[model samples]
Target: MLAVPLLGLINQYLGFLAMIAAIVLVWKDSPWQKGAKVAATIAAMALLGAVLPDPPEEGAAGVARKDRKAAAARTLTSPSPSAAQDDPSPTTEPRPEAADYRGMRLDEARDKAEAAGFGTSDHNASDDDKNIWMRSNWTVCFQKSSWTGSETKTIDFGAVQTGAPCPSTDGGAIPWPTMPELTWKTWKTARNEVVALGVVPTEHLRADTAYLNDTLPDEGKYDNWRVCATDPLEGADVTINTWVTLELTHPDNGCPDPSQSKEDRVDLPDRDDDGDPDYHDPFPGDRNRNSVFPNGLPDSSGNSSGGDGSDGDSWNCPRTRWC
Candidate 1:
C-alpha cells in the first residue's frame, strides 16, 4: 500500500492523476467491490506518493531567498577599485616624500638639513643611554615622531668637541685626550655661568647640564667627564662669540687648580674637594684672572658661536631634557 514503489513506476504527473482517480473510484462502487478496489487503488496511490520527489519545505524556501538576496547585493555593490576612486574623503593624503639622512632618522625641521646634504651619525646604542652627541656639530637633530614619521630640530654643532677621537672600548687604552679639556669643575660650574652670562637661558642651561650628566662616556671609566665646550667660552668678552673650545675630560681634570702643578700630575678628587679646593674659572680666557691674550688662548675665531645667532634671544631653558 506504500506509495513509494508505485510512484517510482509511474511518471510524477501520472502519479498525481492516479491518486485523484483512486479517490473518485472509492466513492462510486458497490460496498464489497468498492472496498476491494478502493483498498488496491489507495495502496497504489500511497506507493506513488511515497516515491515521488518531495515539494520544498519552509526551511528550503528561506535558504533559496537568502541565496538570491546575496547575489543581488553583489551585483548592486560597486567594484572595490572604482568605489575607492569615487569616494571624496581620502584615507590618506599625498605627503612629501620622506628624505633619507644617511640612516639617521628625520624630523620636519631637520629635513632642511638633509636637503642641504649633511650626514648623521648614530649615538644611541642602548635604551637607557642618552645620545647628547646627536646635537653636536650636526646641522640638524631628527626624532622619530611615529613609527613612520620624523621631525627635525636644530642642534648646536659648535658645542660639539670636534677632533676628539671617539671613546675607546677596552680598559688600559691610553685616553687620547681632546683640547680645551673641561674639568669636573668646569662642567659643574659652567652650566650656571652660561645662564648668568646671558648666552643661554636657565632652562637651556639645565637641559645642557642634564644632557651631560645622563650621557656616559663610552669607556665608562670616568663617570663625571662629559661634553663641554670652550669655544664662545661661557663669559668671554668678544664682539663675536669665537674662541670657543669644546672637550671631554674627567671631573678631576676639570678642577680649577690641581694640588700638584702641571709638572707633577696630582690625583684629582672624584667628588668636590672640601679642603684646599682648586678654584678655576668655569669659563675660558681666564676672565676671572684678567689674562687677556689677543686671539684669546689660541682657540679664538670669528665664527665661534656654533649655532645660528639669529634666534639667540629665544634660547630659553628646555622644558624637557629628552626629545
Candidate 2:
C-alpha cells in the first residue's frame, strides 16, 4: 500500500475516502493507528481543497501538482458566463495543400483525395494497359495538381509496382503484330514471333528473360521454359516493346500448337506503300508514308532500299523487299 501512494492520481476523492476508512478501522492501534490518522488529516485537507476557492498553489511537489490541475480547470471553467461559447478542443486539423499520392495505391488514395472535398481528376498513370485502376493491381506513380487538394488533379499509375517509375515517354505507338497465342510456347520461339511482328524484342522481352542454361533436371537445352501466358492477349494494339507481361513457366507445361497455321489470319501484307507493311508498320492505312510521320521508307535485306524522292517507289526493289 505504501509503494503505490500515487495510484489515486486518477481520482483524489476515492483516495481520501479510503484514507478516512483506514483511520477509523485502526483507531485503537499503535504505530499503524498514528500513521492512519496522519494520512486521514492529509486526505481531509485535500477534500477541503476541492471545495474551497483554489489558491495560487505553491511550487512544492504536492502543491505544484494541485496548482497545475487547478490552473487547467480555471482556464477551462471561466468565471465569466462566456465559458459556454469558448471551445476547448480544436474541431479539425489542417489538411495537406496537395496530398502526396505518389507510391500510393489507387483504390484507397482515390477515396482519400475525394474526401478532402476537393475537385479531383484521374488519368491512366500509365498508358500501358497493365497499369489500369479497375484491375485493382496498380498504384499512383505520378500526379499533377494545383496548390490545393481542392483543385483538379491529373494522376497516372503504372509499373512502379514492378519497382520502376512511370512509363518512359521515349517512344510512340507503332504498328504492332497480332498477338500470337503465347501460352505454352517456348520462350525462344515466342520471342521470335514478337520480333517478326515488328517488335524490338529487347524492351519488354529482355526484362523477362532468365537464362537458365541449367534448365530444370531432364529439361533439355531447348527446354528454356515456355511462356505460360502473354499480356495484350492476341491482337491487342501494343507498342513494339512497351511493357508486356510474359508469364512464363516450365516447358513441361506444354508447347504451342504449331499446328495453327503460321499464316492463318496473319495480316502480313503491306496495305500501305511505306516500306513497313500493315503487320509491321503502324500506318498501314496511309499509302504514302509508314508512320504517324513520313520518312518511314521501305527496306530490303535489313537495308533501306527505297527511292530517295518524296514519293515512295513501291515498284523498284531488285530483290525480295521484305518490309
Candidate 3:
C-alpha cells in the first residue's frame, strides 16, 4: 500500500513507464499535452517493446509538403504565362519583281514600270522639245534588259518605229536640243535617230567627194547609204526645231579625182579666210589672226598661205576659216 501510494503520488516509478503512459493515454486519464509529449511517449513505447508506434502514413500532410517543393521548383525553371503572351512573333517583307514594257506606248510603259517598283530613264530623248508625235506615236523597239529580269535603275530604249503596234509618224517628230552620238549610222538611220531626239536634219549631197558606207541610197534600199558628217556636227547640242545638216556621199561608188582643184569642191563658207570653217572658227572675219592665237599663227613657224613670194613657210592661223 505504501509503494502504491508513493508511486501514484510522486510519479517517479521507472518500471516500463511507457506501459503506464500508453495506458494513461488509452484510458484518457491524463491531461492533454503538447505534440512533443506524444512523440516522446511513442519513442519510449518503442524502446520498451510495447507494440512499437507505427511511422506516420503518407496522408494529406506528407502529400502537401511534397506539393509545396514541386511548386517552388517549377517557379524557378519555367516561363510565366504573362511573359509568354507579351513576346512578339517574327515576320518578313515581300520582294519586287521585274515587268515587261516592250511594244507599249511611252506613257503606258512609264506607268507600268512605276507600279512594279522600277524607274524609267529616256536613253535618247529631247525633253525640252517634246512633240505630240514623239509622245503619242512611238513604241519601244528595244530594251537594255529582258522584261523578266530583276529590277534596275533605267530601262534603255534602242529605237522608235511607227507602224501597226504604234500610231502615225506624221506632223514630224520631237525637237529635243540634246547632243547625240551618231557615228557609223546610215543616213536614214541617223536622220530617224536625231529627229526622234527633237532635231530636224538638213541633208547636203556631196557630189564631188567620194563617201564611205554607201551614202545617199534611194528609199528603202538605204542599206548602202551611210552618213559621213553632220552640220551641228555629231556631238554638239543644238536648239529644238533647228536645222542639222548631214553630209552624205558614196565614197566607194564614185569619188572625184584628187588631181582636180580641191579648192573648187563645195566647202563651208569661211569669211575670216582661216583654215577652219566659219561655223567652227572661234574668231571669224579677223584678217590679222592675232585675235585667236598669240601671233595669229598655229605654231612659231608663222606659215600663212599668202602668195606674195616671201620664200618662207606660210603661217597657219589658229582660228581662221580660209585665207
C-alpha lDDT of candidate 2 relative to the true structure:
0.50
For this target, which candidate reaches the highest TM-score against the unseen true structure? Answer: 3
lDDT of 1 by residue, 119-173 (tens): 3223332222434444433222222321222443223111112222222331122
Q: How close is candidate 1 to the true structure, as a TM-score?
A: 0.22
Reference-based lDDT, residue 264, model 3: 43
Local distance difference test scores for all models:
0.39, 0.50, 0.49
Q: Write the per-residue lDDT of candidate 3 for residues 64-175, one digit (tens) a residue.
A: 8889999999997887888767875666655444466667776677677666666665443322244435645556644554333453445554335333222133222443
lDDT of 2 by residue, 68-123 (tens): 99999998776555654674646775535657776677666667777765455555
lDDT score for residue 312 of model 3: 29
TM-score of each: 0.22, 0.23, 0.25
Please estimate how well model 1 matches the true structure, expressed as its whole-model Cα lDDT: 0.39
Question: Candidate 1, which ten residues in sequence have the lowest lDDT sum?
Answer: 288-297
TM-score of 2: 0.23
Which regions in candidate 3 have their CA more than 4 angstroms from the true location? 1-98, 107-229, 237-243, 247-323
